[model samples]
Target: MKTKIVLLPLDERPCNYLFPQKLFLHDDIDIVLPEKLGDKKIPAGLKEIDSFLTKECKDATGLVISLDTLLYGGLVPSRIHNETEDKLKERLHILKDIRKANPKLIIYAFNIIMRCPSYSSSDEEPDYYEEYGREIHEIGAAMHKSHLGMENTLPLDEIIEKVPEKYLNDYISRRKVNKALNLASLELVKENIVDALVVPQDDSCKYGYAAIDQRDIRKAIIKNCLEDKVLMYPGADEVELTLISRMINTLKGRKPKIYLKYATEAAKSIIPLYEGNMLSGTLKYHVLSAGCQLTEAYEMADIIMAVTAPAGNMEEAINQPSKYPEYYAERNIAEMFDFIKDRLSEGKIVTIADNAYANGGDLQIVRFLNANNLLMEVDGYAGWNTSANTVGTAIAEAVDAYHFGTTERHQNFLGLRYIEDLGFCSMIRQKVVERLPEYGMNYFDVRDKEGKISELVKAELEEFIKNELSSISNNLKILKLIMPWRRMFEVDIDVKYIK
Candidate 1:
């Protein structure tokens, strides 16, 4: 079946983190985007999601569109002043024309979490927006906080209380404009423009934290809206649940009950690794193909240990890094490596079932794994990096095999212990580190910055890439061809200086 999902999410920030590329691609779900929404300015070689969504999709069975991008105050180009009722009508008309070209299309719609602009130390809305971000943030915070007593609930009068008397009336007028935009998107259901509406509410929407509380909100939304008529549910842009459901629905010919047994055993070990380490985690798999990476983590475990047992601190040692400016911490990759290595030693296999690692830098990590022979046996997807849930799933799979030990296959369980160095670090990251000392340098300030460094220190740092870091780039290219799927596993190893 051909499904066409026309997605317009709340600017790139919400969509990328919530509905990661790996999670969507794993289920063969095709994501479609309109051209109006451009890239969110991610740096070199990283997969620009807007590029893929807007241009790469093929014909599909359903079209899921996010209304938030259209009405969201956070999106870069959403001009509420310019986007009057007539403009919205014209936009909808264009979308309707596109759908007419696709005969077997069903629509799924999503609303944005009313978000206050998240800020940073340097200043306004973290490099994306200008003054408008602050303006909208004040308005959004007011609207979301109106009419309800709780921290997360709405209290309408609060909007009036907060803004100055001069701007209060104008703020109310703009809020009405945004609310009307939201209503118009929802009204698509009534007009038959879309089949189903998914008004998702994640932690950010309700609790002010950036997470989707799946059990509480998803269940409630399903009961209230998705129960009858068109399907409506609460899920953040993080499409884990929705993708999993689609995979389950696509399943054909039945298999033995042992598969379930293996899955149950696998879940036991893997669940603990991610208890609170990540914002959220959920297990999902395509059954019948033990070839499936999720299953491979279970089948390959050799020395599964008992419950609550202490594995080494390898989880803390290895890191899973991203090139995006937002995730600047260098320890991320080291921590991930530590977690996976420790678990594998305890005879736990790893399956990062939920969070997908999307950037090119992530793919490099896979090469590091394949070089060590851990990629094939350790079991995980390139798009899906190691989150705590995935780490725990690996443990569960190992434990299940430990209890049912046949003993002969134990030797095949390759030792995934972390070694000193397998060779991979982000090149762009190297450039960033080398340039750090030059941050505030002007002619007058040159002595202040350069006086601290010895001649030896200056020379070594200057030659960092030409002599020291050049091998990283060379190794990455060679590894890319041999282990194309391993890119996500690589991390920049500049800690020698970063620390």
Candidate 2:
């Protein structure tokens, strides 16, 4: 019998962009989505999500319940808020109600990810909240305008002082949300409301918010819940999606082991690693960003890991525009190279991809990396450095473009970060999970350090590769390799998109 799974993503953008729809491409899984969840509305109704659990998911054998989606109104905001007892309690009641209706169905739930609340503008403006107090006041005014339509913008200082302690308290409540979600995940299991929990490995979610470390809180929740069934799986979004899909394919006839391969060729254009004196802070953010370790130390290696940000003027590269003139003149490539070549004498491998954001005299960064034998690129679409989104649709299109052959679609890019540290891994994992049914793999449960995942998630990852590796040649390998490397580790490269 075909396995039927239902996925209710908490946020609209992530729900549509990365989820089961993309995950099931490699499998024959039948994934069901509620009509309300699909509505163009920004916030998926709580009632709508609950209706699916009671009405639609009632007959399904297994279901994945993203608590973040079910509560907090939306995904980003839910994670972006401050946690409090009241707020946490409010969301938990909703989940409790859903579990009361279906005690037999296996439910996989996740605690909401905590994130610092901040906003960005597409115009490339500096994140003003860090620089000026007025920008924050403006935000408060906008909020007031939206809710109360107050005239005469309140004085910035007045608003700061007058904003109700309650409202401001709610705005910055990470501690409460963390506690609430932790308690809910455990309580649900204790109450037998959920069969398993799937916690994603997302620590940065709280970096911008309060000082609380969610890692510890999640571990405690896992211990309190039944350890046998409450598996604490370690996976990001991208990894989760792939793992989920792998589960489905295993049930199908796909083989269980595979290796990733790159589709592009660069015989004549190999970027040789520069073997000379290494510059402390020169030759690409790709290289500079990776400088957390000893620079002189890396020069001695056969391969060097680089982290280049978007292309920009050597001026912008050397100094922040916010501090332009003081350090601006130091942006000379000749001067920068003089210091870098000395370290290159030490054998190193420099990985790179030209970022599109830097303001520079020319695209010399890639040329420099190439001239010095220091370029390795990963395959994937990458326009944003910190905000890389895997265009699953684009990847699907690329797959179709190549007739499922990695070599056919040679035009690709490398990831700036390593696989393990990438934030986008979760998104990719979500997509992979959504696609499981087609491959006949059943995700009995999925969890991370946060919750129902066992310590065997890595084994599960290996199992996934084993199952789907042969189905599409090295497609999974390439996707898995490129997706995380660029997102987590920094490397220098020649040009942004090799394709």
**Residue-level lDDT tens digits of model 1 in 123-178:** 21233224334443444544444423335333545533544554444434543554
Candidate 2 structure quality by residue, lDDT tens digits, 45-112: 66666666667675665566666666654554454434456665676675566555555555666553
Best by TM-score: 1
Scored by CA lDDT, what does every candidate get? 0.34, 0.37
After superposition, which runs of candidate 2 have C-alpha atoms over 4 Å from their true positions?
14-19, 25-27, 38-42, 77-104, 117-167, 173-178, 190-192, 201-216, 222-243, 246-499
Candidate 2 yields a Cα-based lDDT of 0.37
TM-score per candidate, chains pooled: 0.43, 0.43
